[model samples]
Target chain A: MIPVLEAPPRAPSLDIDCELAAAWLVAFLRDEMIERRNVRRAVVGLSGGVDSAVTAYLCARALGAENVTCVRMPYRTSSTDSLDDARAVTEALGCVERTIEIAGAVDGYLVNEPDADGRRRGNVMARTRMIVLFDQSAKLGALPIGTGNKTERLMGYFTWHADDSPPLNPIGDLFKTQVWALARHLGVPERIVAKAPSADLEANQTDENDLGITYLEADRILSLMLAGYADAKIAARGFAPADVALVRGKVDGTHWKRHLPTTAMLSNTAINEFYLRPVDF
Target chain B: MKLAIVQAKPRKGDVEANFAALGEVFAQLASEERPYDAIVLPEAALTGYFLEGGVYELAFETEALAARIAALWRAAPGASRAPVDVVVGFFENAGGTFYNAALYLEIAEASHRIVHVHRKMFLPTYGVFDEERFLSRGRHLAAFDTRFGRMAMLICEDAWHAIMPTLAAIKGARVLVVPSASPGRGFAAGGELESVAHWRNVLQSYAVEHGMFVIYAGLAGFEGGKGMTGSSALIDPFGDTVARLPALGAAVLRAEIDFSEIDVARARLPLLGDLGSVLPDLLFDDDLMPENVRRGGERPVTP
Candidate 1:
């Protein structure tokens, strides 16, 4: 007698080979920064999160610990644990560390608009941190390396032009869960890896709470959605349809944020419009 | 015959700098204990791969290309005394139309001559590739005689199509040299980049199926953050890897290969012979034959 058999579940995974990813990312940073651009030192903004810690570790590995400078930019409302975790990363890597308080700089412009919302204040602080980071980079002749992960960038959770301002980014292509996996593989501190991610712009601001989904869920949904899967197909893979819709909405709606500003193309030589050149060119 | 695969990382839009760098590599190879009979470099070895509209500015005219390479060979320190063949990929400006082409040069102690030039046949226009937008397509394919034996060259995307290699094999090419600037992507497969793993399979299959030696030189380094995977390899006629470079970096890999292995492989398998005998009939099938030929009016001339 013939028997019917059930198919195996098709659960999606954001899993990557951490060893290969680390090696490729290290080589990428070394080539893009030291060899291609002829810059040996790197400046990374440390937010005491897994993403920043992984970036710091990669930078140290690529350019050596002596060439990486970790800057901790905290606002008045930032948690002390955040600062401690950032210090722990610097100590673990044996790289240069600096703590720059941006309360005065962010408040200087924010004082004129007391009615500004939390988002406005957070963006100001983010821009202020970038200003300080760029100034420090110029002072040391070091290039600023971006620490934003693919999940946050795709979700449009970063401050436009501020959090994504750096000219070199080794972790931009990695998803949040994938970055955490890489952090653990690189021997990052378990405290930073295990803690809930936050921007540290305000109190009790957890990323999962803000995004309404866990990073595991977001990464899985994103991996499937970005591969051109329909929402129904993604939902069929044991994900909630609402969550898939949310992730898809964020990814599709934030397309403009991922590109340079649109230019008016009145001629054949319009910059970034008609005329084209590779980024390195 | 001894062969060397040079996985090079050329600077973007810099022809003179790349030429000088290649000269250094040539000089280094010359001083080695064993001299190589042939050396192969990756596609767009003079200018980086993703030039877009910048190809117009960086392309070299046919005469200038031969002259520059000759000068580079002559000026290289510790130049090899024996005649050596070097295959290089470059953007060419031929009769006002630009093409992505490979130049085969035979260099001796006092003079150098152009052996052949193979313009890239397939210009990938999908995904990360925009070659068709910037370069003209090649219209011909032929196997040329070299000191090492009869050989053919296929640029990066051209090798992806099976017809290119089959045609080369049918044209009596004993060796296939592929110069590539393939960007590394798709790492979900495990240990190496998926592109690298896939390339390994493709290269081994080609070597085994055609019973021809495959020498692949892949570009290294980054262009616009896209890393060119460097898994340059020398595969023997039996689909064995004789030498290989690392997955990423600019390096030279050298190996001494026996040309007699091609004869042994073909003697045992004879896949090329089998394919050649059946290809004409397959081309003349109902679906493939021209209307006149299908109607038994006239047989088309075969090139």
Candidate 2:
């Protein structure tokens, strides 16, 4: 239950019409997946988090429960509760569910790199899961659905090509706070919705703690910054200067991740670098 | 006069496929027992919008376009011999220069006539739109005579400016058809899409201010993740929406165009007449106009 505040410290400017957003996203999924890609089935990686759970629900709504295949891939150190939560989502949605233990696959590669840090191991596990998702999608003739949200995407918190690999994402443009609101509207499991967001890469790892800022504060600052607000103005609006700077740095540093690999433009007819054509074209 | 507005979703960079689909639409409408006097399609109905460098290949000459459309109408089954006025937008290639234009054609069973063509005057070059880079802007605006009544056409960005509608009204146009290809954006606060709401507000204001029937034809479908807003509508001269399509997907909306409503609105408001009387003097008055406008130059001078 949300605590009702007579007067909150600050109202967020990220409110969206959940009803309209749901309809639009559902249609978007159908358009891109069904009509454009000529596929009626979806393969989604369910991490027991709000983002993946919401994506599962939308996939079920768009392509029906029978056509949506939810894959839960857990590394050796992944929380068991996360597996249980992911199972609960499949059960609630009545969609097909599969479990693939990625411990062996990730560990087989890491055995050679004994001095690898947690970040490297985490990336390995993420890419291992992506491999399973793509293979499963090919086996079932289904398309993989993306679940990255705007907050994590803008902060560049996702695994480079692993977490953001899918060609279509229904919730990529929504902020994390807004995704929570959408989850509630879509009747997502309350346990998943209320839990602290995590990549579940290591023990006692939480997203807010790693970023040194809460999602609420990060979303507010990022929204303002994206609207062309100066850093000083954002700090003047009661956001901590350090917090604003941190968010700005992460966003500015991750510009390469959001775009395709740059191509050398030798002539005016170069692909994507000079000779531009729309994706649909 | 009864009008039919088609919110079409053209395949990107494929004119043949779009024309085939449009042919099906004409056949479907012509098969109806109650014939329509006119049909209005959205801008870039034959070639999808947002084609950065693909417009050159898709652009068609006016005569070729007419010939193709006439062939399609002639081939469509159950089409009546009575002429049907069609207003559809396309990418036009005149000699070597290309432009974003709309054509007013009277399609019949055996013959077709190109009534008038309105090239887009205001090419939006900001934000997601990069029209001015690819196509040349139009120079003139005029109202032409039709079988049903005197009508005028304005491409999407042209209607965004108030002067376009005012000039069309002054030229004795009782009906204004605006072919638009606007993408949906800004979902903060309002229950509706912000772009759709803004279009409704401006279209209604233009209708009421000029006392003419405004028919808006909007494009629907996604191109490179940019979804076109499909809230096509018909607003009467009294600022009332007679018919409207949904905010998503392709659809066809039919509404009766009662020319007498224009008379009622003009008699009640008479704002167009008042503006017309003073527009002549306002155009030539040196003090009232900006120095650059009076000099007919592109740039403004320093005071």
Candidate 3:
């Protein structure tokens, strides 16, 4: 739930009704948006970091501490730091927590598949985590609340349907770096925010390490690009040509992943138009 | 004209329950001898939204529901004298595809006609909204040539895109109706609701800039897993709230909006014509943003 920043609406002529934000947005999303729709409980995959930390906090806030549960499914290659962080976060958020060590689970799954690239292995771990989450969500009358931040979403840093596919995402728009900003705002533990971001599926595998360049750099580049600046202009904003090229390429490659599968329109009228009518009527 | 904006919670995934709730409200209004000019409801009223299905599955028993609703509307006080147009939100199945639609029925005819159907054009994928996953977005804008006046209605996200309302206004719409199931603020640490002044002001600005009356009907009460607060109301041509719902559920706020105010605003400002002349190429990125710079300027677009 992105706030209005207590600022005026962009259109001076239009009033944004931000008072409703203070009065309604969270309650609407928490009670009616999730619960009335049959999401009786919320299941979160806590990584112990600020993004997940904040997401967990918000889940507890929205669904109540009892209805909020966390699964810390660590792999064999996962870090002890992540486990500790996860525990700390769950404790702080005041939600129920469980640990389902996935080494045995992954071994069973990998028996049919090749080990392949370590990167692909991480994705496999991620997807495996989702399988557990969805199954639990169903069994417990809960909906998975995703913790992927805006930076991860924009770069396609997450496995498709893994860490995505939440009934509701509380922090999907804030960038990784901005996530830290919001974490501070939410009174998140500094130790969690101070550390580098990792998928925790392997050793020495931080997010920026996999992609190259820190979130601080990536967000800066992304913001410039979204602002509709020319590539050279974005480079002028203080990015190395190679850095800009890499991030831009990542965005372009990931763009299709973010949107619906496009259909070729040979006829004047399309059969399935997703956006054609007004909302309230 | 007496406009009644109904802000209430519709039972999620239960069309029969929702229609019954609406019927209860209508019956109550009918007994009060209160002649309402129009009864406006929240977006996608009958089909509690976000069902996991394709458009075909979303197809509702609108015809049967309409017949029952039309009867109650016709019998409603002042409906025949001045005429009451019951504007409702429902799932409309067209050629096996369902759309989020607004059905307007004139109580005098006892028939529910689609005077306007604003399919939400911009399916907000971000935030809590997942319109793209369920409902089909609208293609063409719908403006109603009603007994009340030339009017247009926009579905939730459609209001975010001024293009729909602008097209309707060009089609002679003097008033705009927006119905939304907007995610509202939750109970925070301080027990404080977040600020939504930005969006409320946006509506006011839309009304003022277009020199048209803007009526927003929001779904109130908790639905799904979240709670909702009703701020449903009207923004006159002068960008002032004429009437509004007081709480989150089952509120009926009424007001008399003057169309002459639109005419006066148009005569005074006339910003639309000037706004139309602004060229896309002339605008730059910094021309927008409207916040602390997230990043520096752009590099260049590589071919």
lDDT of candidate 2 over A74-138, digit per residue (tens)? 98899998999999899999999999999999989999999999999999998998999999999
Q: Is candidate 1 or candidate 2 better by TM-score?
A: 1
For all predicted structures, in order, the TM-scores are 0.95, 0.95, 0.66
TM-score of chain A of 1: 0.96
Tens digits of lDDT, candidate 1, B39-126: 8899998898999888888888877887777777767677668888888898999978999999999888888889999999999998
User: Which runs of model 1 end up more than 4 angstroms from their true locations?
Assistant: A1-13, B290-303
Q: Give the backbone clash total of model 3.
A: 85
The predicted structure with the larger DockQ, 1 or 2, is 1
Error of 3 at B13 (Å): 7.4
Model 2 accuracy (lDDT, Cα): 0.90
What lDDT does each candidate get?
0.89, 0.90, 0.70
| Candidate 1 pairs with clashing backbones | none
For model 3, how does the per-residue alpha-carbon lDDT over A1-281 read when each residue is reduced to its tens digit?
88666775221111123333323434544554453565658888888667778777666766677888899998888888899999988878788998988788877878777856787787788888988898888888888888888778888888887778675776665567666766665667889989988877778878888888888888888877776777898787668989888888888889866755688877755544633322221
What candidate 3 gets wrong by more than 4 Å, as runs, is: A1-36, A107-117, A165-168, A226-230, A254-281, B8-14, B27-37, B42-44, B48-66, B72-84, B89-104, B108-213, B218-231, B243-252, B256-303
Q: Candidate 2's residue-wise lDDT over B1-303, tens digit each?
A: 878999998888888889989999989988998888899999999889988888888899999998888788777788788888888899999998999999999987678999999999999999889998889999999899999789899999899988899889999999999999999877774578888888999899999999999999999988777888989899999989898999789899998988999999999999998998888888887765675465545565569
Give per-residue CA lDDT, model 3, range B1-303, as digits (tens): 678888867765556787677777876666656577788987767665555343345465556546767876665444445456777777777666667777676655534564555565666776556566666777777676888788888877788766666676666788988887775543222333342344477788888887889888887665444444457888888778777665466688778876788889888888755555553433445655545343444544559
